[model samples]
Target: MTSRKEHALKRRDLAVNKLTSLGDRIIDDVAKQTVPAIRVPSRGTSNIVYDEDRRYYVLGDRYGQRSLGNVKQIKKIGQMVYMANFCKGLVQTGKTATLREMYYVSEGWDIDFGDQQESNIVGEDLEVTLGITREDLGLMPEEDGASVYGDITLKDDDVEINAMRMGKSGYTISPTIDEVELLDHNVERVIAVETMGMFHRMVQENAYKKFNTLIVGLKGQAARATRRFLKRVNEELGLPVYICNDGDPWGFHIAMVIISGSAKLAHVNHELATPNAKFLGVTASDIVNYDLPTDPLKDIDVLRLKELYKDPRYRDEFWKVEIKKMLKIGKKAEQQSFSKYGLEYVVDTYIPEKLDAL
Candidate 1:
């Protein structure tokens, strides 16, 4: 196995090689009096394929689009060059920068991005073009979207974290998960929650102890670090993972991101997605079975459901039935709705029932 330091060096070398090759190509194109073209993964579900064997979504080799002689193409080339140089600097200095910092850096360099969103598009393109993550470019996200609680220990460099021993609330999962090593854990499974309210409820109720499981809060969408940590736990510890989210479209998408990976992060999907993770609750049938409270589906929720209903990645029979049922019911359920039975119902009744069914 390669050491982390060695891996970082290799990644840096690869980035440098790519930059050198790109520069060579541009010179060659100029010499030949031809257009300089670059290829990037298409930024949508269309170019993303579901790998049944891997149980995750991956970017396909389909030719998305070619940047040639258009003004947009010229602008993209400039952005890519700038990003490559930025990454090179980070590698040379052995430093890291946040996504916000990168955006500000671009602004400081007088990159003509209208807003942060535009800057992010260029960053995504760079990831696809380089076949690496923004993190590999030494850019971190601002939000740390996960928290952990269980009989687990993490060793990050010289610092050690015993999650279960970290007071009553447990440890906040670090954003720099790639730099951390999972030293030890003695848990049967990991239960990942999508909402903070339910996560707090589970922690307050000692759900991890009751079920002999590890609890992680996604806070909504799982961050790259959070997903990477989940992947490591599942692969290294050999623990079955379960995702708990609302029955709404957004919650379902969150689960999908964990289980199958997202198109935007296809470059690092293998390192991030927990392919064996199962959906534990808030299924459409739970609406009928548990007699949970329901909120009327919003316009956006309905639109998103319709989109997922037709998505190729969501073609499973079970998912199809679930979405159909949701459409028919015209309502969505939250994880918190399980509280209707009792505050302890989720930690005691709902979780145990779902675990037994697994």
Candidate 2:
């Protein structure tokens, strides 16, 4: 296994190469008396292509927006240069920075971003331009999400944890998935739960042990580490992956991101997304079939569902039927709604039934 230092050094080299190329381009443009242009992938669905074979989305290099001559392009170039220098400094000093810290660092740049959103856009631009992730540049986002009751041992830096032996409440996953090594695990499948309430209930009920499975709590939208860890577990460990989320548009999106990758993080989709991961229940149909309690679909839920309905990735017949049913019913159900029969129903009945079907 490559040590953290070795990994960091490799990333540093890549960053250096990117900077050198940019500098060379600028020099060449100057020599030719022409505008210096940097091409970056456009950040949207239009620039993202789904790899049906891999079951993940990747950013296409076919079309790129050139940063050249215009005031906006000039400011963007300044931000890129600023970010490159900052990342270089981090690598040289063997230091790490948080996304928030990087945002603050932009305050000292020649170009005023006016807000954190503008600064974040430049950071994303660097990811696309450099073909590297923010994490590769030693920038960490706020840590959220965890795993519990997995028959797996993880070594993060000096800390080693046996996930299953952590009693009822399992270990909090490391913020940096790159830093964590899965020493061993004897599990058949990994179930990523979207809600913490359901996750906690499953752990409390020892659901993982009962089903010989691993449970990962996404909390809501998954963190980079959670997604990366899940991807590694699926790819390296060869575990069947499943996701359980609420029967709503947002929940569906969470599952989609886990399975096909998010457009925003398209550059690192291969490293983080598990395209083969199957979508397990708490589906729109589950509400009616299980007689689970339901809440009226909110305006936001309808809007999100409408958007998802239009997305090409969600055009499957099952998705179409589920979404159509949701729109027709105008209601959504949370995973916790299964608790109406008793919390044990989800672990004892629902999950097992889903596994049998799988």
Candidate 3:
């Protein structure tokens, strides 16, 4: 078996090769006294398509041209070159930078980025251009990754760590797991929760011990790192994943994104999407079934549900039925809605009932 270190090294070497090729192309164009142009893969929604075999959304074959011939695009080309050079330096040194750090780093460049959003796009351009992930290019996440708690053991570079020994706060999932090794697991299933509050409550209740499961807190719509880690847990650890979140339309979309992949990140869906993951989160029907307190749905929420009903990912009968039920009820509930009974209600009552049905 290839060790995790070897895998990371191979990825690093691939990134370096791509970066060098990009630089050579620009230099060759300059030496030939021609308008230097590069074809950047389109990251737009129009270029996103569902791959039935892969079971995820991926980028279609559409390219955008960045050329020095166009004065309007000169600045963009400049920014791309600078960003590529920076990433090359990072890969060469075996160092990593967060997107935020890249934004700040751009301030020192001759053609600096207008803002963080612009900086982020340039970084993404490199990934699509190279056919690799930002992580592969030595880019880290600007925000910290998600939180996880369970009866599991992981090794991060020479250190052996136990999830149980980490206490109630548990372990915060790192931005990349390329070098992290899963040594062993005492868990049976994986519960991926959206809110930190509910995740902490479950941990406080000894749900991991009681249920023999790993609990991951996604902290809203999961970032790429979190989704990738969940894929690892489901595939490598052989643990089934069930997402838990609010009963709102956004919550439903979050779960679907993990299962079917989102258009915004279609390029890296193969690394991030986990189609086998199930959405066991709240449903609008829960309002009537459990007599739970709920706030009236906003017009936006209704609009979103109508849109989801037409989304290819939500074509399943289970989603359509749930969307209609939510529309009929016109209300939504949070995961904490179970707390109306007691703090232990989620672990002792609600979760047990849901798991038994599964």
Candidate 4:
């Protein structure tokens, strides 16, 4: 296995090579005295396609171009080039920046971004063009938003830390997960729960010990860091990844995002998606079968379910069947609904049944 330092160096070199390739093409285009145009895969909704084989969303054929000749797009082209240089600098110098910092840092650039969103688009444009994730380019999110608790041991650089030792809050998952290595672990599975309350209960009850699994708290929609960690757990540790969330569209989409990748982030799906991850429970069918306490489906919930019903990722027979059931019942269930049985039911009966089903 390659050492983390060596791996980081190789990755940085490759990123710089890609950035240099883009630079060379633009320089050559300029020398020819013709308009320099760079074409990236269109990030529009219509241009996002689900790859059935890979089981993830990917960029489609439709192209969005930034050309020097197009006055409206030239400013963005300048930002793209500058952003490419920024990424190259980051990788070369062994430094990092947040997207917000990247936006503010542009104060020094001639082709400065108008706002963080504009700067973010430039960074995303680089991602689509280079086929590299923002983390690989040394740009990280403002905060690491997920936590983990379990028997798994991880090596963050050279220091080894036992996840279970962390209190109820658990270990904060790192967005730049490539830098961390999984150490020897006794965990059999990884269970990622969507709610903070449930995560706390699991942690407090020593659920990891009960199931011999690592339980990660997603703090709602799983952040990039949490998803990356889950993918690593799935691929590297060969542990099954299962998500337990509500029986609504939002919860369903969260599981789908972890499993198949979201359309908005198609470019980095390979790095973040876990195609084999399973939705543990709280399915529309589970809502009926478990007879868990439920709340009436809101208008927004119905709309989202309808949209997901048409989404290719949710086209599986199980998804189709469950979504129809939920719509028919006009009710949604939450993970907290399991509390109706008792505080221990989720960890004891409910979880085991779902695990056995898998």
Per-residue accuracy of model 4 over 273-306 as CA lDDT, tens digit each: 9999999859877888888899999999999999
CA lDDT of each candidate? 0.81, 0.80, 0.87, 0.87
Model 2 RMSD, rounded to 1 decimal:
2.5
Please report, as a residue range, the 10-residue window in candidate 1 with the lowest summed lDDT. 1-10
Candidate 1, 1-358: lDDT as tens digits = 6654566578767766776676687778879998877777676767777778887777888755555688757776887778778877886776788877887888777556777787788878877877777776777788875888889988876788898898766778766677676778888989999877888898899998898889898888888888888888898779988999999999988998888897766667887888788888698888978988999899998899999998766888989999999988898999999888889998888888888887
Give the clash count for each candidate.
0, 0, 0, 0
lDDT score, candidate 2: 0.80
| Cα distance off (Å), candidate 2, residue 10 | 3.2
Q: Clash pairs of candidate 3?
A: none
Q: lDDT (0-100) at residue 38 of candidate 2?
A: 85
The C-alpha TM-scores of every prediction are 0.87, 0.89, 0.94, 0.95
Q: Which one wins by TM-score: 2 or 4?
A: 4
Better of 2 and 3 by lDDT: 3
Score residue 244 of candidate 4 by CA lDDT: 88
Q: Candidate 2 lDDT, tens digit per residue, 1-358? A: 7765466567677777776777788779989999888887777777788777777778877656565687767777877777877887785665778878888887776666777787788888877787888777767776755666678987866777899778666777655667567778988989889877888888888878897889888888888878878888888889988999888888888889988888778788987888888889577778888988999998998988888888877888989899989988889998888889987999999988988886
